[model samples]
Target: MKHLTLLVPDGQSKLSSIICTYKVFLKANAFWKNIHGSDRFSIQLAGISDEVEFYDGLFSVKPHVNISKIAKTDLIIMSALNNHDYPGSISRNKPITDWIVKQYKDGAAVATMCTGAFLLASSGLLDGKSCSTHWAAEGTFREMFPKVNLQTNLLITDENGIYTNGGAFSFLNLILYLVEKYYDRETAILCAKMFQIEMDRNSQSPFIMFTGQKQHGDEMVLQAQSYIENNLQEKIVMEQLADTFAIGRRNFDRRFIKATGNTPVEYVQRVRIEAAKKAFEATRKTINEVMYDVGYSDVKAFRDVFRKITGMSPIAYRDKYNKESAVA
Candidate 1:
């Protein structure tokens, strides 16, 4: 049997992630027993404390085993941390982080649910590995773990036995993925039907809300970003815009990338696409009408960029998100 350890992390962790993950693994084991006449997962909640409480003790979890007592584990699932307090959680969970590092080196595969990526990333096993987390947490995550590759567009990332998924509720998708990988596709599909979770969801791009990368303290880059966002329908000439800002085009491109993590061209494209996404979500505009309003004149060019960024064609995105448009 595969011994699965669900971590009940300390310091304002999401109670639902721990509860939901525990339930799924237990159900998976039940499904396994029905199919193979034996249990597949030896699941347990392991944490530093005997009981971890959340929301002023409205909810609490009592682990089956403490971290220090477990010597061998086949898998580890970290519950998501509270978005507003992950740094504090990481600092307070120092012992847990250290234990995770030791456990991973001892051959236990680790998976993180949503913002749980922060704790796993803190363990240093993800220092040079690719990771995924909630798209809204991208700014803070990038600032905290610059060495780890943060792929916010992907719904799931699997590298070197480390698995991560994007944002809330999306953790269910990762659980399904792990089930298929270690257990079997038959069990995964069974669980999917039991839970009513859509399967094979591989991208979180359409859900991203880009407000422009403005976390740095570069004043000139800030001004440039504001310009790009304000004039989303314009055909921006980067070199000319650089000249207007009283900097050489090359120096401007260098500084823009350094501050915003995107080149001037990519930044402008994102701003335009962001506007297009909003239109699709909230308005009843046609695909070509919205495309032109966002500054793209070529039908093929606009469709290609839309699909590239959102992982869906314009009509598909609109149909999925806009109720009025879907009916139309």
Candidate 2:
């Protein structure tokens, strides 16, 4: 377990709506501590100023401490800047940016929430690194820092040591990611329950291949896809799936094909291929091991499907990604 520190700018006067971010962080911290009590992860509030001031007319306290002199930490998080939420000139504090650069050199994993990416971009740390911020800030973020690879749709982007998340709801996603990294899925679930929030264990990965296309299509087809993602490694019978939806097998098949342009069995195979690809990234398991885990008992049939959809054998695909990763 490691101690994490959060540094707040001194002249900021008071914390604003961004405190919602810290609240979520504390809740996630408590959950992880409870699960792994002894030698568990911890967070400390370090302010940049000694005299705390409240935002005039707003009920928030000013943070009081400089980024320098903070203790060693495994992770450092920069909260969203309130004014950056709206369209305006971005005046990042130079001192803050300089401190962040120094911390990065000290070997701390850096991350920002929402418009906080603005601060990171100012520091020149996000150069050539893929990052994400609140969807609304995409235009301004790009205009200010064109060198940073900005991805708007993702909840979070984990590029090597730096991790950035979209603001607001994404703060939860970021915390859940931390939980999953240090703790386990069960602990993350309990932490989410503490806040009465639903945690997505698979948010980092694609949920369904046709999520964008299916959002505008038939609801039945969407349900079918959801069922398939949940049961990828299990035996699936089209008849049983249709029965669950209270539709005749023929009608269900027609709707499924119309919405996704793939038959039910075809969709399942596609999912199996995706699973095999992911498995290949982790284990040097043989094609047979990959196929059996993804519900294909017959090795020859799995190889045929792999070649048909991927245009390459399983070994070839694995070797390609492996070599690419190594070169990278």
Structural similarity to truth (TM-score) of each candidate? 0.97, 0.54
Candidate 1 steric clashes: 0
- In candidate 2, where is summed lDDT lowest over 10 consecutive residues? 204-213
Candidate 2: list runs displaced more than 4 Å.
10-39, 51-57, 62-65, 85-92, 201-328
Give every collision pair in model 1.
none
Q: lDDT by residue for model 2 over 1-328, one digit each (tens)? A: 6766565643332253246546756666676666567535566655555543445544545443455667467777776665643323134366666777887888888877767788788889999999888765665677678799987656688987888887555666777676666667776687677766667632322222222225335888888888888887788999999999999999998988756556888888888888898787777777788898889988889988877666568887787766544454
Best by TM-score: 1
lDDT of each: 0.89, 0.68
Native-vs-model 1 lDDT?
0.89
Output candidate 1 Cα RMSD: 1.1
Put down candidate 1 lDDT per residue, 7-112, tens digits, no spaces. Answer: 9887778888888778877888898898799889888899999888888888888999999999989999998887578778888888988988888888989999
How many residue pairs clash in all the candidates, one count each? 0, 8
